[model samples]
Target: MSYGPLPKRIDPRKLAEREVRFESSVDVDQLPRLVECLALPDGKIEVDLQFSVDEQRIRTIVGSARGDLHMACQRCLEPVEVEVAATFNLAIAASEEAAKQLPRYYDPLIVEDEEIELLPVLEEELILSLPMVPYHQDCSIQTSFGDDAGAVDADGAESASEKPNPFSVLAKLKGQ
Candidate 1:
């Protein structure tokens, strides 16, 4: 979604408030890093946001938003549905010290005509909520190996067949 310019000057003396809702679609291919991790097929991003502005040292803003994205399974590389929801509070300060009093992660957003654009910040928050590991909760893939295998020779050692790199006496010698 596109947002208009924010108010150029926010008068600390006056209380400024605004509310907006936006909807937009983002191409999965545009997010190359996230796509590499998810390996998702072609998909779109859906977002819903509700935000308000209040006066603080400079101006304070708060918002709540939710998003839906399509992800790919880590195990079988299949499509999976993912959802994210978050609540945020932000402050725009005239000085660095005033900004520091607010949240460290708060970004300097646009303000115009006593209005602020929150869509960009909301999108970023949604991106941060993505899971480190994206996989289906109930994956359908199965392997032939089961849990019946027991320890080799009763010493709690793995079987020879299970060794990642098996040793061979003949192979150890350079020449025989």
Candidate 2:
């Protein structure tokens, strides 16, 4: 996949009667704002978009995007390879006003007489699909707190052999 400029324009009215296939890839750096949260690897997005335009509205956009990212694990704070695969459906209308009248979610991509670029929209969609707390399925650290590990219990009491809190005995004497 190659990261390039977006098309000057995509006439939904012209595509109303037909389907279009948009296959492209975009570099993460090209989207500076979105790169802040995404731990993007040196990779390009592989997108296979298939959709139709109905009059001035994009009816159904079904596609899949695959890419690799480097993100820190939420649990261990270690960097890990993240494989992203997202499938999405979007409706593009002429304007936000027109979309507001629609029942489903709609994104307004204005079409001028120039090339219409889908990179921005694609980036937004991908960002939304990202996991809030990303972690490896098999975490490296062990989390189980066994009794022999000297962990405190729910009642704020340590194991019998553990060091006693001096304040506890003081509190008991005061109670008497």
What CA RMSD would you report for each candidate? 9.6, 7.0
What's model 2's TM-score? 0.61
Task: State in Å the error of residue 99, model 1.
Answer: 1.4
Positional deviation of 126 in candidate 2, in angstroms? Answer: 0.4
Across residues 73-143, which tens digit of lDDT does each residue of candidate 2 receive? Answer: 87677876777777776665556675676555444444433334566667777777777878777775644
| Model 1 regions more than 4 Å off | 1-58, 103-118, 142-176
- After superposition, candidate 2 runs with Cα above 4 Å error: 1-18, 54-60, 105-116, 142-176
Best by TM-score: 2
What tens-digit string does per-residue lDDT give for candidate 1 at 56-138?
Answer: 33455455555456666766777777775656655555556555566565654434344333344555666677776666777
Estimate every model's Cα lDDT from 0 to 1: 0.51, 0.63
Q: Candidate 1 overall Cα lDDT vs. reference? A: 0.51
Winner by lDDT: 2
Steric collisions counted per model: 6, 9
- Give all TM-scores, in the order shown: 0.48, 0.61
